[model samples]
Target: MSKHVAYTQFIDFEEDVKIRARDQARVVALREKKGWLFRLMLGLVLIGPGVLVMIADNDAGGVITYAQTGAAYGIGFFIPALLLSGFIAYVVQEMTVRLGAVTHRGHAEMIWGRYGAFWGWFSLVDLVLANILTLITEFIGVTLGLGVFGVPHAVSAAAAIAVDVVVLLVLRYYAWERVSLWIALGNLVFIPLALMAHPHWSTVVAAFSTWRIQGGFTPAFLFIVLANFGTTIAPWMLFFQQSAVVDKGLTVHDIHHGRMDTAIGTVAMVAVAVALVILTGSLVHGMPGASNLDIQQILRVLGQRLGPIGEDLFALGLVEAGMIAAIALTASTSWAMGEAFQWPKSINMPARRAWRFYLPGLLSAVIAAAVVLIPHAPLGFLNLTVQVVASIFMPAAMLFLLLLLNDATIMGEYKNRKWQNIAAFSIVGLLVALNGVYGLSVVMPHLF
Candidate 1:
């Protein structure tokens, strides 16, 4: 491992953690015994993973999805709908915590070992390609957001890639993670921006209990729905979380806290997602000229209503969202490639130590940046393609994930309990059926 942070690289973090078991337990106890201190400490210690997960989910495409959702629905039902999406995200990601801890292996490695090369190749292909495309979108968000601040696209794109290279190549895991977390956590700027919109609280609340669609299911509704689903959870999330757990050297004892981290991320994601939908939906969706606008278009319209400040905040949130997702996606691609090919891959290692592990990510960031620069590319269709790929790969991803979690050898005594299995399978079934409906709605426009 490269010269990195003190905790994990120099020693077996899994074993060394045992030496500090006393302090670890004390920290947990301290968190429980106090209120404000617990909150503060929790924020300090548990901040990275949650912020990463949430912001990664809210990638550039996600912002566009939320933007479009707000323009069409006007905060009618999507606010509460996002609550369910967040819950789903938590339930799904929490499984990876136990899987990573119990097995001491990344998801790709586990799948390759147990299921053999066919499935391993399947998973890898999905992760690498999806990651590359997703990174491109992140660059797009950054460039577009910078456009709001009067930066040239080429300069912003080059600067963003350079910053990523420095973070990945120069910074050690601890510093890299901390910097990424701070940038990712800036996704919460949306909350204050939403609050500034001054939406009617009663109407927002009613959108939840009213059980009414703003104007019934339309093509725009379908677009936002799938986009929301894609943004909330995807193949990259699983790959990233599992690899993170492997890199972090979490053991069985930390599974509980790991799950807690996932849960915190879930709530924060929904809070921001809902706030965004409600902010735009209530403020601009039903305005005289607002009708089924996309995210970029929505930002411009929101500026018209709330002035430059609202638009600027939206742009800032968009950039943060993209970069946050890019960090996770790139990390995920590196880890999965490393594990699948049996290369040395760990954030704890320096770039020299794990050049093979880190190079894929760097190259991906470069290619993605280039992809964003292609003249008159059909970005709208490319976003649609991302969603389509997610739908296609989801069943296989969930199946492999379930197989690993249910395997007695891997999970040991911590295998999925009945309720966990129920939740997992239920999610799978629901997603399958939901996609089917979405498909039918696309083919037969009047049915939904």
Candidate 2:
């Protein structure tokens, strides 16, 4: 009886080993079968949130700011400055990735849970309000762009709203991200427009070497620089990217991928900004009375210089910029409200289940659209107000971000390094001073 038992045990152990070997072989085979196409698909799936935030950062406001920079300063100092801002943007946003992956919490939720109601509501209100105002600017860009092709403002606003609704309602989180990424990719149209302008390559190369401002550091020049800073790193971006990273289901293992995604986006965003500057700089820079040209006038100048193709492409870029930003800003608002209130807070939730989460964003968009359609609205003042509000709210947002990143109870092994903290603090200090200056300039026009 003992011998029979021993033989049976040996047989069972052999069977277990064989089973283990088979499973291991299967896993290896599956891994080996993952070809370049498979890897590519996987990468695409992992790359949406960061890319969306970066592209959305290059919104209508950003495009206008870059165009204005090129038109006014002619790419002397702003190009390198934009490149540096891109790096700063990356540094700041990378914290969002780490925070999201490690904590699986949105920025608003972190502020609320870690701090208290006051700071939480403070951040939430600031984000939602900024989002609404930014949405208005986006619609304005959309209507203006479409108006170039004879589409009325009402029709354009309606179309933009419908598109936003369909994208949010019909798609789950992954699908929504993928769709938004494709729309964001449309922003690359500015590149060819830059080429069409036929910029002098030698001069473009020499600008960086010289690194001199065309008009020196005048008050107007400083204002544009601050505008560039404001547009590049907004409160909405922090909310949007963190919530997006969480919603996208990224884990700590995926942090490397997230960083790659953000870096790629940074390059793409800077490239587009530089291209816009080059396009407008080549055509509109130093033109008679062109220093203060609005976006419409900039497009008109493009049409005049490069003809209809140039005009149409620039218009298309504006439309894409506005559409992409609206998608991100609306979603950012929804996510922040959901996180703050502890509602069903995912784009993956079906419309019926997540209506509460979606309502705030939808309402904000609708209100913004309605505002845009009103006859003879003070759009210039409204745009300035957006910038000013963002400036006022920026320091608070950065403070919360820094606090959360340094919270050892939350971040564990992934907390901010000393260098990162130093860099971030330096950035915050500079932004605070700049925002103060900008605020004074806006409120008291003669201060600068």
Tens digits of lDDT, candidate 1, 1-448: 4322421233354543553354356446656766787767754654455457766788888777777677777787788778888888887888888888888788887887678788999899888998888887788889899989999988988988888888877875556778888787788888988888888899888877886676677765666677678778788888888878766656686776787778777877888888788778767777776664656778887798789999999998888888877777778888898888777777767788789999998889889889888999777677756865685577678888998889897688988899988988988887787777778887997876
Best by lDDT: 2
lDDT of each: 0.78, 0.85
Deviation of model 1 at 278, angstroms:
1.2
lDDT of 2 by residue, 417-442 (tens): 99999999988998888877766776
**Local lDDT at 358 for model 2:** 96
Model 2 off-target regions past 4 Å? Answer: 1-37, 439-448
User: How much lDDT does candidate 2 score?
Assistant: 0.85
Error of 1 at 444 (Å): 4.6
lDDT of 2 at 104: 77
